[model samples]
Target: MEFRRPGPTPTPWSYWLIRLLFKFVLKIFYGTIVVENTHLIPEDGFPCIVCANHSNSLTDALLLVTSIPSKKRKMLRLTAKSTQFGKKTFTSWLIENAGTVPIQRKRDFEGQEVDNTEVMHHLMKALEVGDAVCLFPEGFSRYHPTIAPFKTGVARLVSDVLSKNRSHSDFKISILTCSITYMHRQHFRSDVLVTFHEPMVFTPKDNPELLKPVDYNVIRDLTAQMHQQISHGTLDSPSWGLVRTSKLAARIYAPLGTRMSLGDHVRVVRTFLDAFKTVRKKRDQSLVQQEDDQHNIDPSFISELETDLKAYQDQLEKCGIKDDRIRREILPRRTIIYRMILRLTWASFLLIISMPGLLLSLPVYVVTFYAVRNFKKTGPVFDTYDEIAQYKLIYGLISGVAVWVIGVLATLPFVLITSLLIPALMWMTLRWIEDAVSSFRSFTALGRLFLIGKDTLKEMYDQRKELHGRIMDMAIALDLPANPEEYFAQAGGKQKGRVQGLWESKAKYFSIRRRRKRDWNETLRLYDKVDYPDDDSEI
Candidate 1:
């Protein structure tokens, strides 16, 4: 038997259909235009590898393919887990029909050392012919804010492709780093950000042996930069500065102003500049002390810092006090009422969907609930209502299957209908239960919808706290002026007494330091100089 090809075919209809579906799905789900950097992709024929951070479910891959301009999107083939096609006829049909390439999950097969040599050979052949392949270098989804460490498979594939096609000097093999961010994964009408970084071009003289190790570094650096871009929405220095300044301004001015004017703008700008200077000075001091605390700090500290920084930036954007008076008079009441209504609507929808499932599977539901309750009493595996529902469906399906089989053995004609109807009903009921629970939890005042708004505010507070801590620690380490405002005052030689007093009051209320004992100017200068080191330099 011939196996299906694991890539997109040259069928125009398939390409258009996929694109149309993607546009529809993304619009409905994300609520905003699918912004992309198609210009970064090569216009001419070139062998390329598109590597994206996997955050969403299968939606990540679909977004990549459909978002790309038609010409280039047609030739793209995505490698998926081979097991997706195993023993599931309908799923297999979808995969094969969509022109997906199925990659074996296991390296070893049937007591034999499966080298994947043929797979690489076939992939290289496609690359040589100017086709693009998409891969998730992160291997699996963590659903966390940061990208995971990349797998070595991509490195190996690139190395093998380059080695085999040495004669094709014009064969341009590059890695395109893609970033995807979602406001909410399962929610309808959310926001998503997709960005494509410029490809990293490789030359023939570049060491293949070093490729894997160096590739890891390249990808990590690229991802870090991309992550920052996705979070802040720009990579240009001036734009980044503006973003930082805007955030700082929002936090300082939101409670003070109701509208923007020349005076308000100046005030916000000055506040931002002061905060940026303070943050920079503190960062410098921390680097000096990093040596001493290197052993004590966790290896994941940088990742955590990045995540915190992003959160702070997000809060700043959201808190831009367009008009302080208007916000005070209007926002609070409107926001609270809106949230309450949203919660109720969500709860009602959940209850509507779940009631039928519960009624239909009453027996199975009762048994599973008691079993889960007993199990949790022992340890607590199924802690959530969703987990309990999942268990109910599993048990229900097993029992239904047993009944269907017995019915089939007793009467062959009824077997077919029983097998089909039993599983279908169980599946539908399980889905209904899940949706209902989710809706109820989301819409009820006690559920996520109500808490999410509060959580967002709390997150903003936490981010500020983290930023303040980092600044203080850096200041103490660098021996800078203990107070951030003092450092600013001294550097700028302008001691606006009122400005200092205002900052002092805010810091005191927030539990942030009023003074430190370090000078971080030199450290900040040093960090700026070395932040983007030469590509040849060791990380």
Candidate 2:
């Protein structure tokens, strides 16, 4: 095979062709892809660098490419590992065609010294030609909730390019941070959020003169800013367990009947995590001051809160009940019956309409499912759980398109007609599957309400309330905002003024509710015929 060097700028035709293919693949793989702040990307042929957090391997790169609007998408050049291009494979061809810059690393090839001098020159040349280069500043992809430490490549490249070109009046460059978040990384047909933050612009006329040899402090500062921008747009939890706990706390604290978008849901989770961490820190500090012990919360209280929350979650799981349903489904018996009837009626109608599409697309579904499952057991081992979903997506698209092509060829007499009809059927099949899953969840919630009884349901609600109250207690003890949103907003600043009175009132209200609950329990005990001994006195 003859080797050809890619153009200084990306090839528009190849770039868009690959993008269109991946767009179709991603659309089917992810149930929803929410892109925020597209205006931040420079579109007027200005040199730009995009620093992004790497998580789900190719899925991250693909989603980022597809998320950008078509006007600027083709100009974006991606960076990939040098090892990817070493073999004569489809991946190498695809990356080369798409104009990916190969990055070299020493660890990738043990004992063999590696240098990125050529790679850096290629990136600088591309950016100088009025094209955007997307670099994963984390250096490599990993299944991490929080972003990894950023490499200095971004800083070095930017300073070098800008310092060299700063004499020209028209020279300019922008650095944009892209953050990607997945609702369920390994789950098929899950939702993803991609956000493009405001770019850090550098120009010839800027006051700060970064000379040929930029200071280490300057590079570190730039890296920190990039990290902060990327981290702000993601859920920066330390571990997956903390991420789960934060999400649960958000759901429990949110108002009933409130529908939050993925972006808003993420913000809510971040808020809970911030408040939780802050209060725990204060609790630790309070341990040293004996005089403050009366007012300060116990250091173990945080763990106790987490333990109780987990128990509540476990109980709900056992009962086949979701936390949101506890509030949404607690209704009068007649009202429940009415809602169930209406739900079943709508579901039946949907099922009847979707049957034809489902039947037509069954072959595509079965082939994709078995292929993915079998490949997981016998195919190349996946390093991260999220990587598996990307493979499933690619394989599913290949299978679906292959099936469509074969169908068209089989019916040669009506090739054009069959080609169009098959895709339409597949689309309808997807719509029906989504509707069916949603209806199933609703029906299950109703079933739980009927089978589990309202008394048990109310107990679950109380447990949620108790857990929420404990969180509020922690907030009050730390003199933080009672509302998680307020705490998150006022974070990293003095928070004593805004939420003090508000949290005090909230604390008093929950205290009264606790007293009422205790009184109700006492009344129930008095009504019992058998005399109960006081356990505290006997012990």
Q: lDDT values of the candidates?
A: 0.47, 0.66
Q: Model 1 reaches what TM-score against the true structure?
A: 0.46
Best by lDDT: 2
lDDT score of residue 273 within candidate 1: 38
Model 2: residues with Cα > 4 Å off, grouped in runs:
1-10, 86-90, 204-209, 255-258, 277-304, 329-356, 374-382, 469-539
Summarize candidate 2's per-residue lDDT along 118-140 as a digit string, tens digits.
88888888888777888998888
Per-model RMSD to reference: 17.1, 12.7
- The Cα RMSD of model 1 versus the native structure comes to 17.1
What's the residue-level lDDT of 145 in candidate 1? 35
- What TM-score, over all chains together, does every model reach? 0.46, 0.78
Q: Model 1 — which ten-residue stretch has the worst lDDT? A: 521-530
